[model samples]
Target: MAGNTEPLSPRAKLAVTAGKAAAAVSRAAGRGSGSVIGGRVALKLDPDLLARVAAHLDVVLVSATNGKTTTTRLIAEALRAAGPVVSNALGANMPAGITSALAGGSDARYGVIEVDEKYLAGVARDVDPKAIALLNLSRDQLDRAAETRMLAEKWREGLAGSKALIVANCDDPLIAWAASSSANVVWVAAGQEWKDDAWSCPSCGGVLQRRDDDWGCGDCGFRRPTPQWALSGDYVLDPHGAAWPIRLQLPGRANKSNATMSAAVAAAFGVAPQIGLERMWDVTAVAGRYDVVSFDNRDLRLLLAKNPAGWLETFSLIDPAPAPVVLSVNARGADGTDTSWLWDVDYTRLTGHPLFVVGDRKLDLAVRLEVAGQSFRVCENLDEAVAAAPAGRIEVIANYTAFQDLRRRVGN
Candidate 1:
């Protein structure tokens, strides 16, 4: 019932009511949260429901290959300092789920939406947000999602004349190229650890020249832009050259980078960097991610990594060697039908750790690890994997469906 005070047209009102009822039914049936189903029904009832519901709110759209969900949560937390904020706290970034979230929070003063990489342009068009946060992009869901450059080009074409202030990561060449067409952009130096997908310039098909953190193309003038905001170690440097410490409950540098981007977006909405960071400190986990579940007297920390780029970032978050690691992979529709991305991850980095593989695509993962010259045990299920590990803290990394399955099994 939390929605715009202004009266919606009869059709719109009915659509919203129907969506809510459907969502309630879905939850009652114990299927899922019903965000997607509810939104789909609402859209079928009214095609323009998203724009109508979000019309009164100051919306912020967040899009990235990875970290969009976490970044959206962080931005929402920061925005709450200003007023009532609504967000898709879950990892639902597609149009249907996003529409459901907005409709549910129609009365909120702010809307922080996490958008799927491929749907960013369409969602941005509908929301007409006050700001758009462009995080780093890399290869993901090869069969389902577009290639990195194709996605970047879509972003460029989609965001061509938007009035929203673009908060972009200049450290990523694709991101730089995508946001370059925007008239208003606040570039941030959030580092990109996965460099494989971005070696070639998106603007011109030339090898990107790299020198430390700087990158440029000799064939084309496209280069890394000077960022007004930059992350250096544990601190975020603001546009005024003032250093603000990034203290968060989240683990790893990728999260720090996510925090930096969130703070930048929050700043665009008139919240101070310190206030945003302080608010974000309360978030220990996102959508069951980084959740530590106790199983068989062993502490299993859950981490989700769906692609090569995601796995690259996740490796750094794992507890050091000697602590057994559980890797789960699934090639379900949500995780893409292809498991070839498994080869791109450098399993050798886990050389000193005991490794266990589980899931529908465990064989693919095992093969990749074998080729990497890393020894691992293939487990039939998550319980077996956890039981096989020596009782202590263990790391559990999984793809989309696999992570959800393990989370459910662990009662998370």
Candidate 2:
């Protein structure tokens, strides 16, 4: 039932068939892609559908506060070098979505799954993946998801005594501590740009001392582990000290870190670093992140930033000043109801740019911008915001629901 390539049982076959029918009806009715609903239907019929569908495949679960979707895409692309790969490329990362993806690609040799941070333990337990990539953990969706430390503790407890290889970011102390319980770990210095969530040591609850790129807890012996793979500028250095250039179409150092971790994970599966990087270079965008779509005679570049840690990275990806940056946010169930995390971002970074705010939570964003001493115009919608900007290339940064709204409007 775990790792064999046996044919699906009668119950699982019926469940998968019913799930596919539900997805088709949902899509025809224009009610979204229906991956979530399909998986829901499947699970209702067979509770163990995920395990049964994933039994034959070599699974890799990718989880993080951010970049899990993009990282999942990157890993899937690299793993394709070996054989067919199945992944939830649309960002449906929970149990239902993952089951849909795996069930859809029953013939794929590898399974690269993007898992929600809160559901990682449950998904990992069900899938029994060959590798689990612990990217980085930070405070996100605090109203719904567990607190940063609590999630880390869950990971440590959930993954204890697992046979899967843990490819973790050692730069993040929380991630380091969470992945520490695993017997097999491939430490990667993937660089943590946002450090607010890791001020305290997860081990002894003492203050973590940081100097340059190293971090340690003076009270306890827990510290940054020596990594076998490291991201150095534009290249990734392997364990043998050979530096391979990471020529990726994805922008920013964050993506480079993702690529490095992906390569390391692929290498664990016998895929060479050079081969993996070569395959990864073909990925230009993941689920419309960093996608440039033309609307109203102007090209709108889409960027998704859901939390403070995500906003920090989005700021770095914004176009230079005077490009007219549009900020949008929504506090729907998908996006955490509490918008307090907006204040944690440094919006002053957009001082020189022409700023436009729009979305269901645009007022909340406007107040945060005002408090940060930045000027911005409030618009009724994305069209109003884009029309207000000078016709050319514009940068649009939005949270979960807002980004999807604009993405749909632009026909992307």
Candidate 3:
């Protein structure tokens, strides 16, 4: 559900007017790429504007290393079943984008915001959301974000003080440790497809022991918390052990985990899990992610992978043996200046798929693929790469900026 576009208060009206004007000016001048500048202008006009807007709405704040946008969308859609809801639709997860979203939908009673993993604590403090969904915490933007343990500790501290109901993924040890201290916590057994970032225990500097689904620390008593809303074998298991059917248009177990966690959040707001799952079926493509578009007589499915964990999860959702797959990589500010993370991804899985590499860091990916005994063709231009690709449905997996560039090419 979408919120009212009109602002209600004089101060909010002034801020929104200025922000919208700035956004229009930025778009006209081609200076601003997303909703960031408008948010910046609004916050500059009123430093406490986010707090003020939040005071009138029931907020649901979502934060994660990945899947924040999609999770936010799920929660927003579920909440819309009750009434109008506002959310950050673009891949913007910073304070400015959040403020812009809150301001844009001032008439809405529910605000579902996707805050950046690094900025979660600060935004959570101001928004005081009814429920905070803490998805998996993993290594992302190593140059920008702090260590995973440090972030978990920060979350632990933030959740310790907030009265909000914490809906967290218990599969990740870091996320479990982070939300362990929250008074009102609803743990979800959302599967952590990648555990590379949480090999060690965040508490007592001990090695976390894993035995199938359970995890514990021998050095300390800390362990994986039992989930209340658990997902087991394609069904959402409630606290009472009742199984509920879970289906989604979104592919992969990661998305199923996202939906399970969102179902818990929706339940907290009086929406039934069945209703949430039903709504989730309607959201196939989110912000150009997992979007299949017809281009140049070919069907191209777009997927964004910013880090090794993301790449690992996204690669499993595609089948590229028949057609050539486009792998785009860029080392821009948004994509992380360090493309060294490419080495962490398992390019060997792409051996069967004819690889067409593009972007500024295409050569780096090409070398990695070659090292993995995979053959690749480097094309500087995506159009040219597509032209050379096998005539069929192609999967184009790209990093942050590269994914956005491809989205623009597909007219998203």
For TM-score, the strongest prediction is: 2
Question: Which residue pairs of candidate 2 clash?
Answer: none
Alpha-carbon lDDT, every model: 0.91, 0.93, 0.85
Model 2 over residues 8-61: C-alpha lDDT tens digits? Answer: 999999999999999999999998998999999999999999999999988999
Better of 1 and 2 by lDDT: 2
Q: Which pairs clash inside model 1?
A: none
Distance from true location, Cα of 363 in model 1, Å: 0.6
Report the CA-based lDDT of candidate 2 relative to the real structure.
Answer: 0.93
> How do the predictions measure up, each by TM-score?
0.98, 0.99, 0.95
The root-mean-square deviation over C-alpha atoms between each candidate and the true structure, in angstroms, is 1.8, 0.9, 2.6
**Per-residue accuracy of model 1 over 226-265 as CA lDDT, tens digit each:** 9999999999999999999999999999999999999999
Runs with alpha carbons beyond 4 Å of true place in candidate 3: 1-12, 30-34
| lDDT tens digits by residue: candidate 3, 47-150 | 87788767778889999998998998888888889888988877678999888877777567799999888888899888878889999888877787788999
Give the range where candidate 2 is weakest over 10 consecutive residues by summed lDDT.
1-10
lDDT of 1: 0.91
Q: Global CA lDDT of candidate 3, please?
A: 0.85
